[model samples]
Target chain A: MWQLYQFPLCPFSRKVRLLLGEKGIGYEPVRESPWLRRDEFLDLNPTGQVPVMVDTDRGVALIDSTVICEFFEETVDKAAMLNGTAVDRAEIRRLVVWFDSNFFRDITAPLLEERMIKRLVHRTAPDARALRDAMKAAVGHLDYIDYLLDHRTWLAGPTMSLADLAAAAQISIADYLGGIDWKSHEQAKRWYVGMKSRPSFRPLLSERMDGIPPPSDYDKLDD
Target chain B: MWQLYQFPLCPFSRKVRLLLGEKGIGYEPVRESPWLRRDEFLDLNPTGQVPVMVDTDRGVALIDSTVICEFFEETVDKAAMLNGTAVDRAEIRRLVVWFDSNFFRDITAPLLEERMIKRLVHRTAPDARALRDAMKAAVGHLDYIDYLLDHRTWLAGPTMSLADLAAAAQISIADYLGGIDWKSHEQAKRWYVGMKSRPSFRPLLSERMDGIPPPSDYDKLDD
Candidate 1:
């Protein structure tokens, strides 16, 4: 059996979980708060990050969300998320990086730092300026998403791909933290609603981070 | 033909260049200073980052270093950088991320900020403490490299892979910025020297960023 080490709020971990769900891969979810930098977890992944996949019986451990995604995409033939030609795959991967790096860095990361990490680790109030900055960045990001949806059926191309999963994962976390303002972002909101209603994303929306409550419309499909 | 848009000191671009060199795929190097955030470049990539591969004739723009490397690996298949089974490839990619994200964050990014960008963009002096911290981090990173070399021929495994390219690219930039100290990292030094002697790496070592002189032994194979 496979073990997935992750916390409820990590976007990268969520990305892996969504991919696993799509691929019909089963694994035991191991709750791990990477901020604690647990020694055992650090041993599994020197980076001290979560969303680590380990199979103790096989003595196999996969670290990094992207690495894990690529591994299963290679090992399992079902639900090809990185689909299409080499050029198409390149475009898919490009957006994956865009969401993973740019979207995370600009929006999700800051919200986590302010809303989640500061409250949990430091036991302090989040900076008002920082939260505002993240939410503002989210507006711009949603604008970019709207721009993308204007052209392609999906984020990357005609078919669904890892890009959708990556974007949804980050957006989910941002929404959970109350960083996203969905007003005036009809296209992005509609796209996100489609993503939120996915079977793979349902479980993620239902889960809550301890001591932190999401906005009222977080899990509601009608919102 | 392809146009690779990157500045000389950009480690991600160097990684792509190494892979292209090994695969015998040709690309025209187009100078791009991402920090400047030029209008045309921003239109090409909203991320405002280097290592963007474009073919105007085909209207294809491959952004992100990993995306570019994977594209060529899939399309060309001659050099086969992402070799081995799924697990092995995962290990290789994990290390690639290690160098690209962690090493770049702890060492290269700070050093570039202190030594290069402060001088170029801000016209300010580098913080002594920041330089000290980056060099200190470089020691730990080089120790990790030594540990990896103790167990395997290459950083990832038996053969030269994109992992080596990623590590060497970051290290080369760090070395050029005078952030790396080679006093105790004998194993890593030897491995890096081997990487330096490769024909692909030779051009990178010889190229210098304007007004920033590298250390005297920066290009020497004897180091």
Candidate 2:
């Protein structure tokens, strides 16, 4: 049994969950608040970050969504999840880092920090400058995504790899926060619709925060 | 032939160069100024990021250092360079991400953004507040690195892996900027000295910036 230490809304955690679902791996999800780091969680990952996976069978713990996904692909013998040759794997990893770095800071951070964290903590209102910057940055990233999607069915290539799951995880959170204006990019919207319809994505759509309701079409698989 | 598009000081680019050297692969290094978005470069990577690898034999272009390293490891079948099993690979990848994210922002960013970039552009003096925040963040990450080094010979584990190169690349840049205090973390410094002495690290040590001299003992390897 694998014990996954995670937070409800963290995109990194969500990516791990989606990978597990896609691989059909059964695991117990233990919700952990990153701010209030537990000793056990800290032992697993000294960084005190969420989405740490404790593989009880192997007696090993893994942190970082990219690492976890790669581990799963390597350990599981039945199916090959990562696409392409060495070159293809490299491209997928690059896209994963792109999502983690550029997308997180540009799109997800702003949307979550403004539309979600502010509501949760009753802190100062979201900074308009930051929000605008995020929106502007997101436009460039979305355009890049549109270009990538145009080249292949998924982000990395024809097959659905961890790259797709990593992207969907971030986009799903943005969608939950009402950050995405889907109508603006028709191709991106279509790609997302296919992602949302995946069996691995069903659990993500039903995810709800304490006081936040997902967009009207969030639960619609084909939306 | 593998053509590497890189900047001299970019840590991400350094990682790929180090990996190539370690693997005994010959490649042409093309110096790219990130500021100048070359048309051919932009066509290769729409994102216009540096450290793009053009493998003429395979007829593939790969961007991002992490991706390039993984690709190199997979394609080159010699001594196992990545180190260990699937779990170990996961741990190594996690550490690489940590260096790229937390360490780069906390340690390298402060030194580069404040001290180095200022010299390059003659901008406003460094922001004391941001510098302080970066310093504080560095203390925690350095402590974590120290702890990791204390337990093992390298950042990831026993054998020198991509994780070590990833860390060395960032720390080397910070050291060049006179940002790192070698005396503070004895273990990390010791591990770094070994990394600095490797044959693959000679090119990095010989590198000279136009107006910047690294610390007095920068090339001493034994430091």
For this target, which candidate reaches the highest DockQ against the unseen true structure? 1
Q: Which stretches of candidate 1 lie over 4 Å from their true place?
A: none
Clashes of each: 0, 0
> Model 1 over residues A1-223: C-alpha lDDT tens digits?
9999999999999999999998889999999998998898898899999889999898999999999999999999999999999999998999999999999999999999999999999999999998998999999999999999999989988999999999999999999999989999998898899999999999999999989999999999977
The lDDT of each candidate is: 0.94, 0.81
Scoring only the second chain, what is candidate 2's TM-score? 0.90
Candidate 2 chain A has its poorest 10 consecutive residues by lDDT at A77-86
| TM-score list, all predictions | 0.99, 0.92
Worst 10 residues of 2 chain B by lDDT: B115-124
Model 2, range B93-194, lDDT digits (tens) per residue? 988988987788778877777866776776568777877776667667678889887788778888888888899999888788766776588888788888
- Candidate 2 lDDT by residue in tens digits, A1-223: 8998886679999888888888799899888877666787778787788888887877988897778888888887544667777777887888888898779978898888887778776666777787777767767777888989889888899898888888888988877877776657888888888888888788777878887788898778667
Give the Cα error of residue A149 in candidate 1, in Å.
Answer: 0.7
